[model samples]
Target chain A: MNNARRNRSFLTDEDGSAATTAGFVIAGGLTFILLAVVLFTDVPIIGPNEGEMAPNLEGQIHTLGAESWTNFELYDEVDGTWDAESNPEAKWFLIQFMDTDCPHCWNEAGPMSDIESNFGDRLTMISVAVSLNIPSHDSDREEVVAFQEKASLMGCNSGNSDCSTRSGEPHDWAYFDDLDVTIMDTWGVQGTPFIVIIKPDGEVAWNQGQNQGQEIMEALVEMLPVVEAA
Target chain B: MILSTTVVLVISGLTILFGALSRTEALRPLFSTLGLGSLVDEPISRRMIAGALGGILGGILSAVWVWVIQRQEIIGSTSLCIPGSGCVAALSQGSSNNLPFTGLEFGLFFILLFSILGWIALTLHLDPKASNALRLLSWGRILSGAGTAVAVWMTIIHLAFVDDSPAICPVCLVLLVANIVTFAQFHLLYTSHSNGSWNDK
Candidate 1:
């Protein structure tokens, strides 16, 4: 009996052609839009934001620290004067960009000193502190002075080690005391513990943070052979 | 990274425009999917969903991005993508500093905005296929809740580790927000907004 009732027409007499037509139109429309956006931005200038020669930093770089950095002139600690010329010296130069207030940087100072001492013959480790938003020359000196004083206090004097309390790691004071701190920027840093590795040709090899011990070690070991041959 | 981000941005932008103008009802879902939920309603849930989805998408995007950068064959030990270092450093890089708004943090905002557009459309039963105006949000309002989280993540990677300086591509950030927003939108639409309206126009 139920089967007999079900035999009745399921649809009303109307054909409902409009509904079917609407469905087809929607399907076609959807296909077209997806296709359009997919192709448009591919135009040379509009789509991809690629800029000139992968800028020392990507084009948007207003500030350069960590790995994306290079400068024509620099200051020398031993001579206590400006280098004026950026020389493509040793096979590799470990340039660490530091700031006056960076505590993480001080923490990495030990490993950095180790990198310098162990590889001193083969590599050169130097630090430059850059500040942000402080452009005037006068303010620049004050910033540098403040940074140097802080560094001296940390490096030369043995204190309560409040700075080293975080990890209970021993502070490397003497090493940093010998090395000079140059102010690369004024006011403050865009970010810190900014370290860069430059190749003999003066190209930035790597841009990154601290504690890259094994990574740097392995790289240096492999690199020595190539440098020796050249 | 650049190619993938570009491709998705283009696809989504065109589909969004199409959704606004198309007359056909059947095509709505496909275009809407590409739009990723321009048809639902819900503020909090949408962002929560977008941020969560953005994380997964960010992971995929990161992997693909690192692969492409590596393929460039630029010789140097890339610190960010060197095995153990990978894009994980982007997390740390965020801590080192702050960049003025670069539009990358807009992902979560996009999610919320998309969801809100869906909510109002569903509630009003406007043209089932209507497209919303471009979303506008203040930095402060946008940064309020979930945007803060994405910002935090982006901040860490940008400052402590990653390069390209927290340059948040608007398209990728929008797409990222859309993915999660759409997922939540579709789910809520089917469950709650369904009987409410579909052909209200």
Candidate 2:
């Protein structure tokens, strides 16, 4: 049988012993060299390449038009729809692309809430928090929720006393969980706290840089009628 | 998840080690059922095989722990819902985002490198056609020993020094046993060979 022959040959293979002894010496030598290298040097084994640049679209102008807003499927905060339709009562939209940990995003919350309250029914304000990979901060969903809670952006404390005691107009807050920033890319948002005002007809009216919350609202008032007419 | 996986791998390593040391023909059947019979063919080969398996699993599990702790950096977004909104948004520069070389990632790479070396050693042991089987076995022993040292060092640094845990991890303790047995088996083999007792077998 093949098994018997294999067993007999395995026991009688005298050449293997000498070769194994040689292999031992070579293996010992190689291991010694490897250990020395490990002990002496600092090696980078996993992770991103060095000198990578952070994506910053600060001060860049976007030539976006009304036709551009047709297929944006922002993950819904309520219905969980990928392309959740906006409320019919709302005529205009103020979309703010922001990083949850950005100090400027935190600072702009008050001004945005003011605009939401003043424009009531005339305009819908949505804050889209983007996750940023900074050295100290990990801007993710938990951090997004925490930031929303800290700033009361979820309108939890808004006029409605249905859920609990809270204040402020319940602003729409949503984000994309698909890991694709096609919406952000389409808008040419390079920096945090980027604001874009869209007319009811899906035409972009305002694309402003960071830290212009007050100016944005003032500009919105001027453009509201024009957006409504469209 | 990482913690649970580490526990399972550690338990598997222990079973292999215990079976090898006992060398009961009864244990051979059990080991064969698990696809590890040839591994315990002789006193020398058994320890090397166990050490290699332990190192491979330990290296992978520890690396997983590193990834788990830094999920935010790796995946951009988590399922944790915001209190007021139904929206979850994650913005990153690109896929290149978690690629920055960090200590944890680097440690994982090192563990994996040594684990590969341990596998190479295992391969040499099983290769009947290999003329340098004895020499390769020595190398395999060294590789396993080195891998075990790095694994233990990393575990100590991560759990004790870096994370500042009060006790050593049970998984890490199991790896430590595997490491100790590897060296013990190597010593026994060397002594037996030197005394010409190995030839009697």
Candidate 3:
């Protein structure tokens, strides 16, 4: 009976009730604040945000000078070792950092091909295939090689991996395999389909990001005379 | 996914409402299964109700937040973290990551809706003459409780095993902890009641 009486008293305790209510109020308020923050803001408090500088890979990857195009060497399924700087046939280098798996990169290929044909001997476009699948979303070398062949980006034979030399009509452009992303990281390319036009002098003339395929070629067209004048 | 989420939310919301009412006879078995087998004699049904509602609130908030993050991610935006908070990296690559758990959000929204209904039902239960109508409300607790349990489990797994980075949303986790505490309080109330240490009369 005594225990029953005490239990009854506890049940009606306004102090306990008030404390519980207070706790709920505090929790609800905090949850509201969190919801607002997450919903309204961009850039998580923990992750990388936009507006960071694009990496400049001048000396580390390829020196920025006349030798920039001919000296830059990347592996090709056909050519084994393709040299960009030694290609005396081209006057400028239009280097792009792309991933085979990236949809945007695939979409950008048409405009890039147009730029290649239109520029003729004025430019040597090099498509640097960087595989992003390392550590997390890892892509293999085969995938990259296959991407190059299907897209017909130039200088790679997808059907015959062991076959050397440009089997078909050698694409006017060049391709480089950066499966390790050594060049990408050095250039701070966190996204795919990044385009940068380098003059024969090795100076960065223009670079476009995201859905800038048209702008990229246009920029190349605009920079043609600037390169010739130098 | 949306349909399943809705079903879970509606059921959980009903269960939470039922748990809030004073019909211990219907809820006795449930309490026992929830590890609260002590409500036969003494009763702390009010505390249990409070705990259950609290858990629902937290769970709903978490579900909503995750849904929002997914939307931002799709738009090529990052979910903002508190400055210098050192949260883990974004869940995945921005362009490629298709956000998961949209259904969870839908469920949480309905749970919130049901909770409001439950609160109204509780008011009616407090009236002496309206007790019978409120009995139906108690049945909803099973759904609510089960849904809360699932939400809690999913959140824990994401935090524990899925997240490889150190960054975590403290606010989301804190609310989840609050929900867990609510669960504990519910167990405590029922256990105490059965053990003859608590009374709701």
Candidate 4:
């Protein structure tokens, strides 16, 4: 049949075979170029990092004395627009991402409180309590309140019989409940006890990811004086 | 996840090899039992087969790229997207759109399975002596139609239902386009073969 003969001739034809080879070569080359572009390009990230402006965060703040949660926004406290002379009243912000059920966060609570006590005059510490989505680590507003109660008792007078009582002053800082973990996603927090220091002008001075292996206290000690001098 | 990624990569490599060496006589016996031995004798069918395989490869690569970006996000690292660009916004929003498996993962799995079925169909259609050629060709046509339908639905979701903010996901778009092209090629191959364009001799 003519159709059969044509099919046979087409396969044996040198130009046809060459065209197929050229097409494959071009496609393969383009694929390689695309892969290279994806792998090598320096892409900017939206989340917080050292030397970058922190993303604006809005949440419900549970101040220690307040009976109900109050709305809080980061940009309200710290001006986002850069100013050479930072607002003296707008203290440096120390933001902590913690989970009530995390052991590390529990252990770090005492030290974090001590840090707050020392830096209370120079910085405003805010704790953003979040749920890690693990079954055991799931938290609610009540759990956050309970965790605050326990943290308030860390350095209380143990010699007294009423030691269990929350007579001691609670942490003199705002606490926010992120039970939905939306704030965690916004901050790209992968684990608990993540900390970030924001300048009065809203720039991130230090982030846990950028300052690997450095404790929050150490970073504060090293960076706070520089921030004050500036 | 890493293991599955490796498997997909290997399959993609083998498909490319098959397309490139389809005309070699040494490979004839290997595919003879599958009725694909005469693929070397028909230039048009050979090109169609190559096109389909190329689309599969593109889909696999795009899926892998998405998987890598997602892994970076999980580790709290910066993904591959320019700041203030649509890709960055899309990546930020993509975290909230969580499923048990990512969309790219499901797409990869579907395309890999589809590639296997498509290969069998193509070989069957080309084999003039195959007794069940017409029946298998009908199945191929139906499968391709279904694939096209799914691609269109997903494309609609991507374009309209993703979010209020428009997300320009170049990689996701590439993967969807590859899916459409692969199915279109399959439909064409089945239609041509069934219409008796290829000689029975």
Candidate 5:
């Protein structure tokens, strides 16, 4: 009779219901914990807001945002000089973000020569050596020289793998600056071969990674201060 | 490949957890507190990781597609990584690898690496205690999971093709293969469990 009575009491108890409630509470608590981690750090599920203004790029004036493109100060290693800023008449900029060690960039010297020939006075090209881990200045200069020669560039190619034979020569490009990686953090240009052509007004008249040679060249021609005679 | 098995397990686990959280209205408030749904609906919670994988996998797959597009004329990407070629020396691109061949080499490597490693991390993080299997094993459900990966890979290659971009990856195609193997396992498990014939099956 005692055993039977004990069984009856156990069946009537609220432990099962209490356990269910406890599990629900635990799930609830964990949900809050994950949310806490998410709120502070980046979480994919909660994407960054869209239509938000892009962050300002470092090493360039924020006002450049108002225009299609902005100018960067470039220093010539060989001439030990600086490229002049926009010809008040300059209307387009061919901006290239490259790495000194890039093989593709080396190959690009050939096409680049073709591009200069094709566009002539209509384009103002700018190329930046963007690297997070900067090397010695002399080494960087050598790499640039090596890059030109490897690609058989005019004034660059002297038929030698070792660039020591020919001194580094600056292309007709108007600007050359080391990449400000902070600009990558700010504008999020993490990848290399990133290029943008800004108009006289400083708007992104043309932009994409490298390999868009034709498109970039065409955009520059269209944006030039020079107009075709009817 | 057995590498595919692991991807299936993790994705299946995620699907179950997602379904349960969505249905039990109470679960949402807690997830919201954790900031789970700020970027996408709760449905796409794992998509960022998935999207990154898509890019990687797509590059790997593009090897074969690129080989096809280039015809038998050439066996490599236009920009190759030969020491003399300068494709691999710098520039953040994958090796100036030839397609299909590099695809097989790097493809298998990354697939094994990504599939196994990704599965381990996902399993550890996925809330197993919270899953609701009954909510996630429909015919359509499995297909959607596989489709998400396939679509992402195709889109990347499409862009690459249009841009004449180099260094294609086969990440998405391999990931899709991973998803297929994974979903099949889930189907097997769900079927076995539901029939109460798990022991025999």
Candidate 6:
């Protein structure tokens, strides 16, 4: 009987609950603030963040007149270790992630072709075609070829019979087929018409995702050397 | 993966045995019928519950840190998922449609839930005489059991449904082990407290 009474008294004490509650409250509040800051801040670490080394991209390259798809690795042509000052031939790379079905990509096709025509001497442009995984937004190798051909028709080369003429200039660059969509995931591309400008040294100079409400053309014009009048 | 899963199952089974045998007299006859009556009288320590809670808290915090790194796009040589690894593939598979944010939200929810439960359990353990402490501790046991169940179910989903390839999230595996160990500890606490064995210590 005495033991039972001692146990009952021991189970009713309220000594340290207040301190525990206060500690938890403070810790929880601090954790919340930390997570919020992490989510909102622009930390350049990976996934197309500006000033970071762009992730390596590889895909199947389909040229406008090619008989078969060929392998393409971005880093193979634009060496990550190549310095512009050491190698004057080092060319800037303009990578555009697009879907054949996206309307924004469709509209940007002409402007992108024009950019390639104007800056073809100083930079290399490549269009990475990907599927958005939505209804009617899907694309394949044939669709990629067709999209590039259409864009090419807008260029100075109007002799190609394979493509229907569009409003934009013809695109002379290669169109890569991201069949597995791995490129999209690597770059953290959320939507189509995503543009990234890689410096000659392979560092990401500009990422459209990081610069919301800004046009890729505006960024390119500002960053690229001014075209001299003949 | 098989070895770890087997170890977790064995530990969980032992936890259930101790939980069933330590307190209720009704379970005594059931164990006796199976010639396991001798195990019922075995004395178990309550001190391990604190250790188990500590492990859970640490494991959850580590997982939250990984989640933060992933969300912040802080990928480098030291990141949890390297390029071309299973972790990267799993992350890529879920990147569509803001799915990573959903994962972050869920992780935050678990952190809050476990943190609150750990605090309550610690308070009850330290001040067993606190008003209604025993009752609240019992609720903690139930909730911890539920939390463990959720962890198990998620592990199953990750193994069977996440992808065709066998991809394991190391952080997720740590969370599972932590949840199971904490649940077992809670059971041990219940066994010791109900029989008044904790007071002897």
> What digit string (tens of lDDT, one per residue) describes model 2 on residues A1-230?
99998876775464455345535654674465446445543322221111111122222111112111122321221121112144333466566787645666656666766876777567655666565445433454434444444433332212121211223333443332211344466455677777776554333556675334548767876776633233
State model 5's lDDT.
Answer: 0.38
Cα lDDT tens digits for candidate 1, B1-201: 345545645555444334322333454454345455663332332322233233323323332332333322122222223332323233222212233475322322333333333333222232222222111111112322343355455444544445544444343344334334334333443343334433233
Worst 10 residues of 3 chain B by lDDT: B90-99
What is the two-chain DockQ of model 2? 0.04
**Candidate 5 wrong stretches, greater than 4 Å:** A1-90, A132-142, A145-170, A209-214, A219-226, B1-201
Q: After superposing candidate 4 on the true structure, give the runs of residues whose Cα lies further than 4 Å from its correct spot.
A: A1-114, A117-139, A142-228, B1-46, B75-79, B93-164, B194-201
lDDT of each: 0.36, 0.45, 0.46, 0.59, 0.38, 0.60
Tens digit of lDDT per residue, candidate 2, span B126-176?
A: 443344445544665576567567656645554544312333344344445
Candidate 1 local lDDT, A1-230, one digit each (tens): 77655543222112123223433543453345334433532311211011211112111111211222222221111111113244323445565665434556546656665675667666655555443332221123333332333322331112223332323223221112111222323212246566656455344445453234546666556554233333
What DockQ does each candidate score versus the true complex, computed on alpha carbons?
A: 0.04, 0.04, 0.03, 0.04, 0.02, 0.15
lDDT of 2 at B98: 28
Lowest summed lDDT window (length 10), candidate 3 chain A: A73-82
Q: State the lDDT of candidate 6 residue by residue for A87-146, as single tens digits.
A: 655578999998776777776778887788777777888898888777665566666676
Name the regions of candidate 6 deviating beyond 4 angstroms: A1-111, A114-145, A151-163, A167-230, B1-45, B72-110, B153-164, B191-201
TM-score of each: 0.29, 0.37, 0.38, 0.44, 0.28, 0.52
Deviation of model 6 at A42, angstroms: 7.8
Which regions in candidate 3 have their CA more than 4 angstroms from the true location? A1-143, A146-216, A219-230, B1-70, B73-80, B83-140, B166-168, B182-199
**Candidate 4's C-alpha lDDT?**
0.59
Q: For candidate 6, lDDT tens digit of each residue in B1-201?
A: 234333533454444344433344454444455455553443333334334445555545544643553453322222335545555433333232022335444344456657766676566545544665555567767877876776666556556655444556555566666666667667667666775445443
Residue A43 miss distance in model 2 (angstroms)? 24
Better of 2 and 6 by DockQ: 6
Evaluated on chain B only, what is the TM-score of candidate 3? Answer: 0.44
